[model samples]
Target: MNSLKIVSLVFFVRSMEQIPCPCCGERLNVIGSRRRKYLTSQSLPQVVVIRRLRCCRCGRIHHELPDFLVPYKRYAGEAIEPVVANELPLSVAVDESTITRWRQWFAERAEHFAGCLESIRIRFGYGFVGGPSDLSLSVLQRIWHYVGDAPAWLARVVRTVANTNQWVHTRSAFCPSWQGYTIML
Candidate 1:
């Protein structure tokens, strides 16, 4: 019986630790209990039983995982988008319905995930937000939108463009406009 409990613990951690506790801000301690339910699969509906977890500190129970680890799921957090896209063709990639679910889920939990990403960005630099070469477009857009104030480096770029003297004419083609470029800085 003790060995069985240990085995169940191992499996629960393996499957569910990808999500952290929403209230306590820590990984949940698996409860080692299973519930049976019918789940829809690609081909047909199937009955399955899944393990659930509860936070050790807050004691809030949850069955589904976090969204960052999952691509298009609101509950069953699984993979990042790049990993999913790598397996499938870019054109016929993950379903739009799944994407919509993820978007809604993230919006609902925006504060937590946004703070997590912002801390990483500030600690390791903007490049660390995604990566050097393959920065995710959506991530970049979110960073730009939520970063609030512009950094000194970006301000310098804006100043350089704004100080250019090509703007002698009111309607000159060579004039630098501060519309799109202003928001970047």
Candidate 2:
């Protein structure tokens, strides 16, 4: 599960009570942590320490992710936003194939993301007023209407979908690796 900004790992380690297991609704206990390599907004590689939490009831483990990181992607959301919006990045930090892959990944899920946001707005009655038709709106624009244009909008989307249990995982549910945990909330 992802938090907006991890001001302190100590905060998470001490505040597990505030976090519930996404799978079982049980409290999560810190088991350990793992180091992951992530690209910063400037496309520089950095190592981040992610804490792993385990559900006492289900014995499943989840990684606590920061807002800047997108699950299963190495680049920060800052670096990805421009590319997804079709804006040319100031510098090429990755190969062309990776950029293409990012676009494809987003395109594959854009409609689903929009649908989920729409459903949330309707179900929760978030005072949504009529705007442009969906056909005339980009995915980002649709999201803006629902959640406003927060800088951490992508992270907001990830958290919202995960919390609502509407996330579309790329991995097969039947896979062994997919059995235990989900996106941390």
Indicate which candidate wins on TM-score: 2
Error of 1 at 132 (Å): 15
Residue-pair clashes per candidate, as listed? 1, 1
Question: 90-160, model 1: which lDDT tens digit per residue?
Answer: 33234677556545544444444344545655665765454444344454344344443233322222222
Q: How far is 35's C-alpha from truth in model 1 (Å)?
A: 5.7
Task: Give the poorly placed runs of model 2, Cα more than 4 Å off.
Answer: 1-17, 89-92, 128-135, 171-185
Q: lDDT of model 2 at residue 93?
A: 77
The alpha-carbon RMSD values of the candidates against the true structure, listed in the order shown, are: 18.4, 9.0
Which 10 consecutive residues of model 1 have the lowest summed lDDT?
Answer: 160-169
79, model 1: CA deviation in Å? 8.8
Measured with C-alpha atoms, the lDDT of residue 151 in candidate 2 is 63
List pairs with backbone clashes in candidate 1: 70-78
The sequence of per-residue lDDT tens digits that candidate 2 reaches over residues 85-177 is 676534557778988998898888877878998888889897765565766977778876666775667778777776665777664545333
Positional deviation of residue 16's Cα in model 2 after best superposition, in angstroms: 7.8
